[model samples]
Target: MTDTDWGELAQHWLDRLADCSVPGAGVTRLPFTPEHRRALGVLTELMEEAGLVVRLDAAGTLIGRLGGPESAPALLMGSHQDSVREGGAYDGIMGVVLPVLALMKLRHDEVTLPFAVEVLAFADEEGVRFPSALMGPRALAGTFDMATLDLHDSDGITLRRAMEEFGLNPDSLPDLKRNPTQVLGWVEIHLEQGPVLESAGLNIGIVTGICGIERHMVTLTGKAAHAGTVPMHLRNDALAGAAELTLATETLAHETDGLLATVGALHVRPGVVNAVPGEVSLTLEIRALNDALRECAGAAITHTARDIATRRGLSLDIARTYAQGATTCSSKSIEHLCKAVATGSRSEVRRLVSGATHDTSAMAELCSVGMVFTACRDGISHHPSELVSEKAMTAGIQTLEQYLIQLQ
Candidate 1:
């Protein structure tokens, strides 16, 4: 197959997986769900068609392997199969589909690399159903905590129970851990998910590092009162306090360079038209390429929320739900990615930090990791409108093909 054929194949698979979503809505393939299972089955078939041997690890991560020398460690590629609720088509899926296309092209050309190539469709990278992200990569890295198995979802279904219902054995997760020496390196091709590349009028770029992320669940408590009876000055409104904190968080993130803060989920108790809110619960997240910057921003947000609650005659509480450190790509891997981009396009290779987290952030713990970024339409993702041009997709596939061939 030619380079154009690879791009067409990538688009074909993307369109296929997209059919699993609700009509007019974005993709919603959460881990272990029926849609997710169907997507995996389709992907497995594609892997087999591409001349790769496919299997599932204990965590349900799909692995499609292309053989190489027996003595060399394998090179890992691909990304997660699952996505956040209403996520765009290209977020995680592009990383998986593009590499598989590249592998298929290599097979068509009768070329084999020095190290084995394994295309991985990680089970849960969005963590929408679970409290933690990187479940599959964490398992491969041997960093998954057994206690997390007891964690419950909104429906009160424990992780272990959900796995069992899905026909997986949680007890066997430990046995699937990959030795550090078993992987030569890992490479992922993902959409920029931001406008950096598009703004620069570039088709592809190299990732410098992934930002640190911190998540929190915050609550404000106040006395409930009749909306009509209570004067605005006399009301102790938890929702009001929460609103002020949310704006404060936005301001803090804006003032700090490269910092991103979002209050995505909010809940108000006694959600009635005539009742003053007695309690408010919200989720806050902070992302920064620097650990110190991330921590400082998080602390400032918490402090501002506390002050708002106190002045509003409400009580405040904050619970940290998740934390992951910033990760830099290996220097050698970056060099290879740069060379790969140079071979595929005339565009200058650029480097930028990713504000969004990826499974590669966790895989960095297991082996050397690198990332290639294709430009999205408007740096828009996690929404139905997310898009990348065919030109960009072609550039990405060509770059990936060059990178894998060079590794041989």
Candidate 2:
């Protein structure tokens, strides 16, 4: 009935995160897997225990509702439950637990919101399965389409097929899209997943916008040769061309302010020790809060790749994986969240932008959206070491609770 009890509830969710087996890690709870469903089942039980009505949609997004006055639209809060392989316990799960606990705290206070409050346990935000992020929110926003479902996972099963196996109807996905008129606003309490808050000695961060992402796959083609027979000076190696282009991208991204680029995956044809590679493929991900800046940065990288390939006597092919435009949160909702934080704690809340993608980006197109961030240990996330202290999590919950109640 007290805040301590709500804190305890948060801890219970943390424990579930540790035990849920969705992927390779003890902490990861991947979406659509049996383990993921089991975790969602546990979440349903918790929400029901807290007096919320629970339902799982056709796309597997779990919703918990606390009804309020009929005149006000719903106050929505929640985060994804899926985790990256071998990822940390907090990442997406923190967003899920805090809001639920905050709702519990409110109910204990005998407080009824002026508007209904719904907590969502998003099925997939990590994109660890399909490589396209923000699945749950996309479905809710009507942004995720059949083309998205047609993509194959690592196991060669299309996303639609996987959804069918999990008892979700992919064909009815359009129905899952939310009507902006039914929802008032969205707020997500997530770990910062970066060092800014911790390094600044801050407890919470208010997100301003979600950054745009430009993902591309680059392929280099050249003549393969016997390693012993062809000298480096005479041979045209696709792998070498790829290496040059990768470094060029890195250098250009660094030169551009606020730009981030990474070559995360790579493969070489005829992967043998004795043969020079005839073909090389690599993936590049570039992101920034400014879409124009991101586009310029991407173009620079592409130009560099072409120049490097030409000099190396290799052919280059580049294709976009996905490009998400930057999205800004509603200013009114942000003011509410900041005021709540300031009232709940003495800490000064600063406006920050999310370097990563979230479901809120999708929701922003349709309704007012905002975010709350707790300090991640060393700003590290998506790994086993990602952590946030109990005190910090409690602070975040209190602030979010105040925000939700004030929204009434």
Best by lDDT: 1
lDDT of 2 by residue, 1-408 (tens): 555555566876888767877546547666788878788878888888888999988878889998977756887899988888888888877888888888888877778777888999888887888867777778778777668888888899888888899998889988888878889889998999899989988888899888899899999999899999999898889998888888888888778887889999999997899999999999999999999999988888888899988899999999887888998888898899899989876698877889888878877776889998888888888888888877778888889888977876
lDDT per model vs. reference: 0.88, 0.85
Give TM per candidate.
0.88, 0.90
Stretches off by above 4 angstroms in model 1 are 21-24, 151-158, 165-167, 222-240, 269-279, 309-313
**Native-vs-model 2 lDDT?**
0.85
Alpha carbon deviation, residue 235, candidate 2 (Å): 3.5
Q: Give the C-alpha miss distance for residue 13 in model 2, angstroms.
A: 2.3
Q: For model 1, where is the 10-residue window of minimal lDDT?
A: 1-10
Per TM-score, the best of the predicted structures is: 2
**Candidate 2, which ten residues in sequence have the lowest lDDT sum?**
1-10
